[model samples]
Target: MVNKSKVTINDIAKAVNVTAATVSRALNNNPRISEATRKAVQKAAKELNYQPNNIAAALRHGKSHLIGVIVPRADRAFFSSVIRGIEEIANEINYKVIICQTYEDLEKEAQTIETLVNARVDGIIASISKNTIDFSHYQSAIDKGFPVVLFDRTSDQVTVNQVVIDDYYGAYEITKHLIDQGSKSIAYLTSPIKINIYKDRLRGYMDCLADHNIDYDERLVVESNLQLQDGRQSMEKLLSGQRTPDAVFSASDYGIMGALQVLKERGIRIPEDIALAGFGNEPFTSFTDPTLTTVDQLSITMGRVTAELFFDQLKGSKKKHHEPHKTMLKPGIIVRQSSLKKGLNQENSPISEEYKELP
Candidate 1:
């Protein structure tokens, strides 16, 4: 009688009459392992009740085969989709993921990175919190050649590899769509410039207005946390102001939801009375009283690319991206009823309704 909990991979190897090395590769799902032999080894392990020890394996290889994923919050559709994308690619390579949420707190963000490092994770993929202006935590890890890949929300202060969308382009196109719909007084809801995404989006909106010969109004630009409450406050400020905006464009979908609430409570008709647009094509955007016109960040694709960049930084990886810093994928602008003053069919964009791949 053998103890099921005490059965190890070596024990399973003996039962299958295969070398321990073969068992290890088979268990790890190495591509080189034949399917028949892999199945036989797995069967032997199951029958023997072999219990694999992750800690022991990590000690032997100096790698835990685990990576940390840090996001602002997983409750949102965008972050959750990005996580799914990351996990899919990571699992394919036999690496597991440990997800952490910062809840937009800078302290928690730094602590999460340290904890993952202490656990000896092979790498980390993170999107910084809104309040994370200081890049010291990420920079410290990068200085030591630690694998750190940032996505979506990132800081220019860090020199690490990053996967991000063309924020400027997304903003420009969305704002242009509004302008073409006769939105001359378009109010902008934005955030602090510390994070490059907001800054780029703001730049895009302003540049688009200028290109269309529209005067840039400082009173129409409201900067806040880009949350739902912040959105509401910003929208109120725009409405109560001496000059009323015909349209409102928020840097985030969360913020736009708040603005939408304010608009609805005030009995303002969407698109007709006040056109609205938002970044992050969050699912709730479509379910609103009037669907929202927003930018799709390609959350899942961003995750896969982030994972790939992390692997490129790994020591034994075959493919090395010489200059990964230039990796910037295109963004998709989704048009809907919320901002389509001229109706949905009139949207002069290749990116319409659904997210399309970049050519």
Candidate 2:
């Protein structure tokens, strides 16, 4: 039996009775090679179990046709949906994706970028980790003229192709909804403001409160990691404070869900006692006891658009593309039982209401 790894172009050429050069051209589908020769060479290659060295081919072509995708975590529904969206566009263009997770660690994120760069991937698609504050790592890749498109968790500090949800709009709409439902002391559970998403969201919430003539209480705004455990701890702390919040607007679905569990355990009635809302319209948000009201970031659409943007920046021709651009997908409020204390009230903010009323 022929050693699978040992099979080479010479071996295939011998079987097909052609020179190695002819075999190479045929394998590469060069127009000079006849279709019959191409077929014969390909047939022999399959039968001989000749696995082509993609890395070697990429080195010769100067294009790996491989894209590296970086996300905080693959387990989350929002990130997964974004991946799915990217794949949909990538598959059409015959590109392969290599996904890397940083688990929200800045060090790991930097390392992953370096690793992908050294691997010589044609391009990269990334969502900045929550812990990331420095733009040097991302700037380095851009300085080298590497194609990168960032989605979801992106920052204003870096100049790169960014596709993200309208975070401020999302936050404002949700906050206004809670206010419309008669919530006065609204608690905002958010992440560290180092990241743009959280910062813009916080601004939106505060601005909405101010616009509605409601007092902006610094005591009501809690900052943390915005994870499930962090949510629980933040909620517990808020409840223990001297001022009990009439509503809660968390920056993340995971954080709010954690708060939900704590609230349920403490026998607190949702919406009735404290209206609750979160960002990221995660799948489980639909099935919770009183379904969750959250912001839909158009995750899949973000992914697909980001991939398209990457291709645009990629060197399709000699034409020079200018500086990076931004695409903001309009986010909508998914009003569920959780935040519908006063159903379908007029939007207080000048921004028109875009609602997804789910059962």
Candidate 3:
């Protein structure tokens, strides 16, 4: 085989009649460089098939312009919105996002995080899985001085930049809304009440019930996997009980949808048989048979803010110790036909329940 020619920035610079520094800046599209020089340098670089070594550039600048986004499920509506938000900003900022889905498995989360770290990403944004208890992988990222921003389902173990919804306040407000609708015995459907968001949501539900002087009924609080099938099964179990709940406040939209389907099949009139409300104002909520009243979390905005946070950290302009930044955006409640009853319980006055307070 003939000897291979090694391409270098110097070769491109010589061809464009410019300094290597100028060629480098032009290759990176630095705004400070003149557009004419950049175009010329780029054309020469392309003609010579010059490929800038990203690994060397990263080593020199101590940045890779790559961010890792770890989530439980990328296909979920909430995660999809968040990814869109992140990708939009990242693209604008000349950055790329490497998405990693752990599938709600702790071991998989550990492996993905490690892989991202090995890739030498500039930063990371993550939403911990329900099964995650140990945070050694997270600590390792922090130890490496790599910025980590947590969003949605974050862990309480490590102090870092975070963007999240006010789960407690949102749940409290929704529960209080159910009580305002004259729902005395409202059932609370949710996943494990151990995670911070769910725990806070459950607390809000209980606090609202207490505020309304409604006795706490353990039987009314049903815990499930928050899946569609689990929702139907849990609701069926609740309906089979001695007493039926007047309303249900679910922390999951999937669960609510499943329960709603079963209730309709069983000829149970919504708002008449049971007033229902759920969280995560998914798009399908509006298209349901009787539109759902649910919590609208600006997940996309959170994702954008999280990406911004990572960018800020990567900027390296810190004066004092980087104070942990936590953003809690308030959730809006969308009230639809599912929560409104007819006849005596009919609501006449229009109440703008959707788009509530922003935390």
- Tell me how far the alpha carbon of residue 339 in candidate 1 is from the true structure, in angstroms, after superposition: 1.3
| Steric overlap count per candidate | 0, 0, 1
TM-score of each: 0.84, 0.91, 0.87
Q: What tens digits encode model 3's per-residue C-alpha lDDT throughout 6-90?
A: 6798888778788999988888889999999999998877777776776677778888888899999988999999999999999
Tens digit per residue, CA lDDT, model 1, 1-359: 66787987778788888999999999989999999999999998889878788667767887888999999999989899999999988999888999999999999998988888777788789999988878888877665556888899887787777888999989998899899888999999988656888889999999999999999999999989888899989988888999999999999998899999999999999999899999998989989988898999898898888888788787543344434484687988888889877775535555566655434
Pairs in clash, predicted candidate 1:
none
Per-model CA lDDT versus the true structure? 0.86, 0.87, 0.84
Residue pairs that clash (backbone atoms under 3 angstroms), model 2: none
Q: What is the lDDT of candidate 3?
A: 0.84
Better of 1 and 2 by lDDT: 2
- Candidate 2, residues 1-359: lDDT per residue as tens digits? 66777899999999999999999999888999999999999999999999878778878988888999999999999999999999999999889999999998999999999988888888789998877888788888876767878998888788887998889988988898898889999999988657788879999999999999999998898998888999999999999998999899999998999999999999999989989999998899989988898999888888899999988888652456577788988887888888877664455433223455222
Residue 155 in model 3: lDDT: 67
